[model samples]
Target: MKIAIYTLGCKVNQYETQAMEQELSRRGHEIVSFSGAADAYVVNTCSVTAVSDQKSRQMLSRARREHPGAVVAVCGCYPQTRPEDVRKLDVDLIAGTGDRMGFLDLLEQELEDRRPMEAVDRVFDRRAFEILPAGGLEGRTRAMLKVEDGCVNFCSYCIIPYARGPVRSLPPEEAAARAKELAAAGYQEMVLTGIEISSWGGDLKTGQSLIDLMELLSDAAPGLRLRLGSLEPRTIDGDFCRRAAKLPNLCPQFHLSMQSGCDETLKRMNRKYDTARYFRSVALLKEYFDRPAVTTDMIVGFPGETEEEFAQSLDFIRRCGFARMHIFPYSIRPGTPAAELAQIPAAVKESRAARAAAVADEMRKEYLEGCVGQVYPVLFEQAKGDRFSGHAPNYTEVLVPGSENLHNRVLATRITGTEGFSLLGELEETP
Candidate 1:
């Protein structure tokens, strides 16, 4: 059988999709592009926002419509939260947010029997972390290890808590074992991803935390560059940063989740930390690491967010001076508490996003300029004509003009200039 998988949303979803692809390939099934012909189509969906939900639906619909004879499977947050909505789309197989192996079983069963299958369980009832294969398919430069799953922090604007369930962490030994395997598999980098990685050990009753997991993986896979996924602001402190800073292979890029920077806005969003606390996390990362890339995500024009609050957020973000930022116009997710509040007008939301983006772009340019003339060991991933591109330890994209196949090779490159958002570099030994 030939399977086509289309992934949407966060790195966790991508990791799960890759696990599915790997499993299917091992079962002697051919893995093909989602756009091309295939025996089945898997749509790994995301429901982080209204737009994400719409995209999930569109992709599922397209899979069914385009490949009418092929089996269509839908999984991930979309079906986990809104199974009925997914059922309405008439996909052949439906599995939600758990049991990757079982989901594959359902996919195979559907193909064999031509019977529809639905495997969505109540997400909140899930307690165990589903362990799937960690690495991607052949030739991938980087692999993500999902060391945690689910979220406990029920932010007013988030449906993920309901879609994903409570915090369930992959045991440290399992995660370390997988990290070692990835390193042995020739992956130069391994990303630790989850729904909320900072909340990793909450359910385990063990005193170990994310920093412990990082240290374990750092030791287990000493050769692999370990990077983290989006982290909670509360996760960073003197202890966390101090320990993380000592891990020589840990990438300096820290993507702390900051939906809104204003205290009142954060309060309404039910965020655990305020602007003051979040800033401390940023400050600690910068203080502990050398020019560490402090990145964040901001939601502009959240429900009931006033112009003053938006401006405050803008000002606060500027104060943080993030290396890179993902700015979003808040969209009402129907099941979330924020959806019941007074919604911001779409135009206003978009306008605020544009304004925030302008500020973020300026900060990005400043950060890129700071990278010039520095030497960084870049893990080159791909080549395009005379150029090979990869990323520095801070996750900054660095491109070097080279005819050699630098793919999967870490080379110390000297940054010569900035190319817009990316850095232009030359091999340190190049003439």
Candidate 2:
């Protein structure tokens, strides 16, 4: 069978898609491009926001139109929360956030019998973690290993907790083994991703934290560059930074989640940390790692966010000087606590987002300026025209003129200039 997978949402979704693709390949199925016709089309969906849900439906409709007779299987957070919504779209197979291996089996059986199947379980009742393969079939430069699942944070604006259930973790030994396997598979970099990596060891009583897992993975795959996904600001501390900085393979880039910089807005959003603690985390990371790229996500214009509050947020972000930021206008997601609050006007939200984005753009330019003339070790991933593009250890994109075979090799490149969001560099002679 020829299978095509359309992934939506976060890094965890991407990791799961890779694992499903690997499973299908091992079962004698051929993976094909989503643009082409296939025997089966899997739409791995997301419900992070209303826009994400709309996009997932759009992909499903396109798949159905493109492959009239093919089986359309839908899975992930969207279906986990609203299985009936996905079933209404005429999909043949519908599964939720849990039991991905079982989902694949049901999909295969439906393909053989030419029948429909719906196997969504109660997300809150889920207890065991679904372990999937960690790498992609393509000789990709970076792979993602999901060591944890689910979230208990229950942030007022987030619907992930309801869709993903309670926390579950992959045992430390299993995570270390997957890291070794990914490295042996020729992936130059690995990103440890999850719904909430900070809650990694809470399910187990082994006294292991994310820092402990980092040490194990560093020893398991000493040659591979290891990067982390978005982290809660509350997880960063002197102890966490001290242990993590000693791992030679760990990337210097850290993305601390900061939905709002103002204490009042953070309180409304039910964030765990205040501005002072968040700033402390940022300061500690910079003090430990030389010029490490610290980035974050921000939501502008929450309900009842006054001009003074917004200004405070803008001022705080300027002080932090993030290398990059994902600025989002507040979206009202139904069933969340924020949706029940006094809604902010769309025009106000748009204006605040624009202002925040401008400030972020200025800070990004300054951060890139600081990287000028510095030589970095970059792993080339692809070639375009006369240049091969790759990413540095800090996850900054770098483009340089080189041969195609430089795909997975790390090379020393001297920063020359800037090209949009990427850095332009010249390849230095190998020692």
Per-residue lDDT of candidate 2, residues 1-431 (tens digit): 99999999998999899899999899999999999979999999999998989999999999999789999989999998877788789799989888888998999998999888888888889888888989876878898899999999999999999889999999999999999898888989889899999899889888888899999999999989999999998789999999999999999999999989899999999999999999999999999898999999999989989999999999999999999999999998877999999988999999999999999999998888788799999999888887888899888899887565578989999999997778999888562
Clashing pairs in 2: none
- Candidate 2 regions exceeding 4 Å error are none
- Model 1 error, position 80 (Å): 1.4
Scanning candidate 1 in windows of ten residues, the lowest lDDT window is 422-431
- Alpha-carbon local distance difference test for all models: 0.91, 0.91
Q: Tens digit of lDDT per residue, candidate 1, span 1-431?
A: 98999999988888888888888888999999999999999999999888999999999889888989999999999999888788888688988988999989888899999898889887778888888999988899999999898888889989999888888999998998999899999999999998899988878998989999899999999999999999999999999988998999999999999999899999999989899999999999889999999999999888889999988998999999999999888888989899999889999999999999999999999999999989999999988778999999999999988688888999899999998899999898642
Per-candidate TM-score against the hidden true structure: 0.98, 0.97
User: Model 1: what TM-score?
Assistant: 0.98
- Alpha-carbon RMSD, each predicted model: 1.3, 1.3
